[model samples]
Target: MDGTTVTRTPKKAALASFMGSAVEYYDFFVFGSAAALIFPTVFFPDAGNAALVMSFATFAFAYVARPFGAVILGHFGDRIGRQKVLMFTLVLMGAATFLIGCLPSYDAIGWVAPALLVLCRLLQGLSAAGEQAGASSLTLEHAPDDRRSFFTSWTLTGTQGGQILAALVFIPVVALPDDIKYSYGWRIPFWFSALVVVVAYFIRRSLHETPEFEEAKANNEIVKLPLGVLMRDHWKDVLRVICCAFIAAVSTVFGNLAIAYGVLVGLNESITLWLVVAANAVALFTQPMFGMLADRIGRKPVFIYGALSSAVLMPFYLLSMSQDNELLTFALAIATFSFGYAAANAVWPSFYGEMFSTRVRFSGMAIGTQLGFLMAGFAPSIVTGLGGVQEGGWVVTAGFTAVIALIAAISASTARETKDVPTAALGLTTRRAQRVEAATA
Candidate 1:
């Protein structure tokens, strides 16, 4: 090592983002799992079918709070720093999740049971609204220029880790007798999040603000009312990102609603849990590889291919559930989710984060993606209403996933190719193209 050439590792930044996001997502996924598994019976007992819808509805309630949290937290992230916002999101998510674990069930208290759950879910959503954007922006800013996708990919890879942990932790709990499982098994996952919160806090708190943001601040060029600046200067990119983010609905269909459908259609509960665990486990390995590929090839082709392939793959996975073939179902699920969907999942952090400069990246990403994610967060209720996952059903649900994935691919295609462009030249090509046309004239 040359003494004059000091070297620092961006892996530490990636690790911090990864671990913090994993902890935060652990809290979020636990609630989502419980909503599919336990909340329907415990929170809405009056009407059996209505109970499932209500449970999914309560799951969607959090998204209502996400846009507001995005605005408030995005302001702080843009003005103060990303590190502080990341800490705030982690603590808020833990507290809300723990509170959900403590809430009285419908058997103990009637309609109020779900109402209270709604309030806690809202808090969880708010915390989550800022978590991804902050983590991705921080990681992207810290990474070496050529390695932006690789580092920001860790932020999403953390989410796969969290989902894997959530599924693994729930397996034994789901095996407990009905009384114990309902009373304690579900709550165990939520309470465990408190421990993760403590670990994530110490790691996240020590992180330094990104050099890019520091440079912007030192130069007094930070945007005022970043939301406004984002809308005025970058609304087209924001809209494109919103459509791209909507593909997240594929996740809700795969994770939460699939569990309900599997149970409804007679797959073993343990098998269902293992499906999520296995898929996410595969994602843990593949996501980083996909991200590195994005760094080399471009974010667009990888993401587009992922979206379109998932559209084709969803039917196979959904149809597999109707048969008694556990092994085949598992393979199809892993193929669709880990290899196909994970491509878009790994690429999007850099793909989206690169669309803006550091000055307003958080607000631009948070508001746009959260608003689009509102559709994803509510997909369970929507699909259920459509009878997409009804008994002896795969057509409606398959079509739903296919349509959303197609929209995402189209949205991605419309955006300018951004592979070799530096962070400084994110959304200026249209203007530059116009200038070239004028010069030719």
Candidate 2:
């Protein structure tokens, strides 16, 4: 608002963000699926249950690298432009994913197979650190203040689309006979990411920078060191986001850990994969609705409801899988994931982005979320190690999920409401009050 209205481009921004997120996460989730189902057998055959643990550990490696990625990618995103960082992340994720499909297993390459797999996964972690942060920052800056959550919701809804695609692709691959499933079928989904990346790259290339970033540029307010500014003035918001982001553990638990548990309880692998697909597919529709609801009401209430409800509902969902009833398992999966947790997932992009000025929005969101997501990246391995995957292990898993949710809900409760804050004065800058007054005037 600095004496001028910023022109917004919500639609193109939303589509580009959605498609890029879908493509990036499609590659990411394909790796998660493979880590859960394929890698233990192919890469670490001699280690028994330990093989599964090691495979999940490799999945965690990406998260370990995410904070570093966030620092690097977030710096450039805030410094250069959201568009350029997004392009780099897309290509990096695609290349790493495609290479994962081409890696030789232990039998073919000895210890080098797992070593190479770890290297590729580290690259994926770095790319993902920036993917959602850049996409959400781009979309939020392009959207009108009143409809920010509604449009930015597409960034996460794209994640749902990605999860759905990953599960759908894995369904057939899991159904293949043992030899083919272990060998060639699993690689197809990873290779498919190459096609997705190409399509998304062209679509994303058409979008331009946000008006807000341009306005910041015109004012000569772009920071030379975004991380330094963010840590100094916005440390509280960053901590809050990290705590609130713990809610992400709900997803990794539902998507990755539950799938493994479902198989142990006699459910077919295809059915387990379908359960994830069904929940995420439903979330694709429900998340946008949750985002709209946040716009109508508030982000805090919807987000808290999501965290608390998912905490309350997760035990039943996990326990249902251990029972003889497939219907209950599917129903609980949708209830916990699609209906309960979807609200938080849908709203965080806008909620978190609105917490910082344009000068450091990308770094603030990327660093905070990626740091918190370390727990998500390692949730399955942590839970499995804590005995959450044993015969009566739903207790430990549900308890762990509840603790994480509690921390997130409490953190979200402490944030100042940004729903009414204008796009021009979204962050905690020294001029924020003056800008807010001007924006409201």
Best by TM-score: 2
- Model 1: per-residue lDDT, tens digit, 1-441? 122232334787899999999998988888888888888877887555577888898999988899999899998899999988999999999999999989988889888988999999999999999999999999888887678898899999999899989999889988999989888778888889899899989988888888777777877878778988888888988999999998888888899888888887888888899999999999988999998999898899999988998899988998888799999999999999998999999989899888876778999888888988988888998888888658755777788889999999999998776666655455445676456346544
lDDT of each: 0.87, 0.92
Number of clashes in every candidate structure? 0, 0
- Candidate 1 to truth, TM: 0.95
Q: Once model 1 is optimally superposed onto the true structure by TM-score, how far is the C-alpha of residue 424 displaced, in angstroms?
A: 3.7
Clashing pairs in 2: none
List ranges where model 1 is wrong by over 4 Å: 1-9, 427-441
In terms of lDDT, the poorest run of 10 residues in model 2 is 428-437
- Which runs of model 2 end up more than 4 angstroms from their true locations? 1-6, 429-431
